[model samples]
Target: MAGKSSAGRTRAARRARWWQLTQRWRMVGVFEINTGHEFYSLTSMMKEGMQACIQATSNTESQNSLTDEHFKTKGTQLLEGFEMHTFAAPVFATLRHSLDISEQEFMNSLCPRANYLQFISNSKSKADFFLTYDKRFFLKTQSKREVRFLLSNLRRYMDHLEKYPHSLLVRFLGVYKIVIPNQLKKYFIVMQSVFYPDERINNRYDIKGCEVGRWTDPETGGKQVVKVLKDNNFKEQSIVLGPEKSWFERQVKADTAFLQDLNVLDYSLLLAQQPLHQDELKGKHSFADLVIRTTKSLDIEDYPTHLEPSSVPLLRSRSEEVPDGAVCVPGQHQAAAEGDGEEILAQEINSPAKDTRCPVELQGFHKHHQRLLPNLKNAVHVIDGLEWRYFVGIVDIFTVYSIKKKLENLWKNLRYPGRVFSTVRPTKYSQRFCRWIHEHTQ
Candidate 1:
C-alpha cells in the first residue's frame, strides 16, 4: 500500500510539472506575438484579405483541400472577419493592368487560396512583420490615378485605426502618390522611397540655394564657384569627353597604386589631345582651351591669345610623328599655335575695342607637366570599370571590423594576378599603367 501511494505521488508531480511547463511556453509565445513589435492589426488586415481570396475560390479544389487544422491557424482566424468586397476587385484590376495578366491568372498565381492563407498564418506565427514582394501589385496601383485616389482613401482609413500612427500613413501615401507607368520611373521612385525620400523631397520642394553662401576651400581660402550643369549636358560631356575635372581628382586620390606607376608625360599628352575646342562652345570654352593650349605651348603666356587664331587646323599625329628636338609633342605644339590664333580672333569678335583680362596663366612646361600628369592618369585608372570594381569591392568588404577576420582568411584564397590589367590598360609600350593603378588604389 505504501509503495503504490509513493508511485502515485510521483506520477501526479510529473503531470503537474508538465502542465506548468506547457502554460509557461504558451505565455512566452503570446508575449512574443503581442508585446514589443506586434503586427496584430496588420495581421488582422492580411487575414481579412486572405479569407476573401479563399471565399472567391470556394468552388475550386484548392480551397476545399485545406485541412481543418489550416482554418484553426492564426492566419485563418485573422481572415475570419475579411470582406472580399473591400480589396479583391481593386487589387485584381490593378494587377491585371500592371502585370499584363488576366485577373483570373493573377488570382491563381499570387493570391492562391493556399498561399494567401499560408503567408498570413506564417506572419502571425513566425514573422515579426508581413511584407509582400509583389511589385506588380504596387506598380498597377501606381499606374492609375483612380488607384492612387483609392490608396489615399485607404490611408485615411488606416489613419482612423486607433493604434495607427499618422506619420506612418503619411509616408505610405507619399510613396503611393509618386508611382508612374514607366518601369525606370517606378524603379527610381521605389529606390528614392526606400533610401532617400527626404533627400528627394528636399531637392524637389526646396528651391532655395545655400543660405550660408558658396563653399570656400579651407586650404586655398578661396570661394568655390560650383557650376551646376543640366543632367543632359553633364551626361553628354561624360560620354563624349569623359568625366569632369572634379571626378578625375577624386579618382586619382582613391587609387594610390595606379599613381605610382603612371608616366606623367604620356598621361599629360593624352589629356592635351582631347578635343578641347569642341567643349569651348558650351560657355566655359576658355577654361578648357587654356588648359590644353598652356600644356602644349612651352611658352605659357601665349595661351590667352590662342583661342581665336587665324587658320586653326585639325592636326592628327601619333606619338612617333612628333618632330625631333620638340620639347613637347609636335601635335601639342600645333594645337597651341592653332589655339592661340583662335583665341585672338575670338577676343576681337566678342569685344572689338575693349581689352579684357584673359584668365589663362601659364606655369613652366615641365613643372605643370609633373604636377598634372600623375593626377590625370590616376583619375583615368580609377574610373576604369575593372579597377573601380576591384577597389570598391575591397573597401566595402574590409571596412566592417567584425568581418575583417573572415575577409583576411578569404583574402588568402583569392588570387590577385599581377598581370591582370584593368579595362583601360595602356598598349604594350606603356610602363606607367601598373604604377597609375597602384597609386590610385592604395
Candidate 2:
C-alpha cells in the first residue's frame, strides 16, 4: 500500500510539471470540441492564417512581390478574443514552399489535434522556446529589435537561400505576433529544428569557437543540461566527415560570409550526433532505413499530403548516380557552394533587390528530413571507428555588430587582452569561426 501511494504521488508530481509548462499556451475554443480533453484549441488561428498565406502566395502573379513594402506588410486577424498578426505572410509563404514545406504538412506538423506546443526553457537566453509535439518546428520568442532586424533583411535572407540551397544556416519559416486582449504582445519566429525526425541525439554541442566563458557548468545538474554542451565542454573527438568534409567547409565559408556581410555576429554551430550500434548499422535495415521504417509505421496514411516514398524521384535519380558503397554526399559535385556569394550590403530596404529565380519545385519532398538533407545533410559518419549520424546547423544570426556590441567587445578586450571572445567584429568573428571549424573538424 505504501509503495502504491508513493508511486501515485510521483505520477501526480510529473503531471503537475507538465501542466505548468503547457498550460500557458491553452486557448479554449468558443465551442469546445472533444480532443481527448488534452488540447484546448491552441494555434487554430495561427494555422488558419498560415494556410491562407500559402494559398495567396501561390496564386500571386507579381514579379516584384518580394519588395520591402511586401515584407513590411502585416496581416491581422481576430479570433477567439485574441488578435494574431502575421508579418510578411506572402514572403514567408514563398520561403516555406522554397524549403519544400506544403500547407497541409506544415499545418498538421505544427498544429496537431491532440498535442500542442511543448515549452522548452533550456536556452541560455531569456527568450521562450516552444517545440511542436512532432518536433518538426521550433517557435522562438524574439525581441522587437530582433524582429525589426529580420524584417529589414528578409529580402536578402530569401535570396541567400535561393542561391545556395545547401546552406547550413537555420531556416526561419514564419514570423508572427500575438496580442492577447488587454495583455502584452508576443513575437515569434518559426524555425526548423536541427535535430528533425525526432532523432535521439547521443551528444550535441553549441560551438562558438571562443575560449572565454564557453564551458558548461560542472555543477549544473539537470536532465536538459547536457543536451547543449558548449565549446569548452566539447572534447576534441575524431569527427570524420569523409567526402562531406569539403562540402561542409565550403558551405560554412559561404554561410559565414553571408552573415558577416550583414554585420551579424555571435552565432553558434549546433552539432548533434546520433550514435548507432554495430547491430543497428549492419542489421536488415541500415541507420537511415530504420528511421524511414519507423516513420512508415507511424500511419503514413494520416499524412497523405506529405511526400510518398515513391514520389522522391529526384533523390531516387541521384541515388542511382552513386555507386552502391559510395557515400551520397549532398552538394559535393555541385558548383553552387563555390564563390557565389556577393556583397548583399549594397542592397537597401527601400529598393529591395529582386531574385528573378523561381522557387525550387520540390513537389514531393515536403517532409523535414527530406528538405534537411539538401542543406545540412544528416548523413552517416564514421567517428572514431564507430558509426554515427550527424546533424549540423548555424543558429542565432540576428545579433549584429551594433554600438552596444562594439562597446561590449571593447570592454572584453581590455579586460582580457589575450582571450578570444565571440563578440568581436562580424568580419573577424566569421574568420575565427571558419578557422576553428577547419582546425577542429576533419
Give me the candidate number with maximum TM-score.
2
Task: Give the per-residue lDDT of model 1 (tens digit) for 143-214.
Answer: 343334333343233323212110111122112121112421211001001111011111111001111211
What does the lDDT come to for candidate 2?
A: 0.61
On lDDT, the candidate that comes out on top is 2
Per-residue lDDT of 205 in model 1: 13
Give the alpha carbon lDDT tens digit for every residue of 1-442 in model 2.
Answer: 9999999999999999988765432321112224542323335555554455545455564343477777777877666667778888777767666555776677777666544454433357988666666667877889999999998888898888765655788888888887776765878889987876434566667888798988766443533333467788776774455334434555677788899889899999988777766765565134465445334322345434566565443333333333333223332221221222421221110111122111121212222212223212222111111266667889998998989999998999899898888888777787677767766655
Local lDDT at 85 for model 2:
82
Work out how many backbone clashes candidate 1 has: 39
Q: In angstroms, what RMSD does candidate 1 have relative to the true structure?
A: 28.7
What TM-scores do the predictions have? 0.18, 0.66
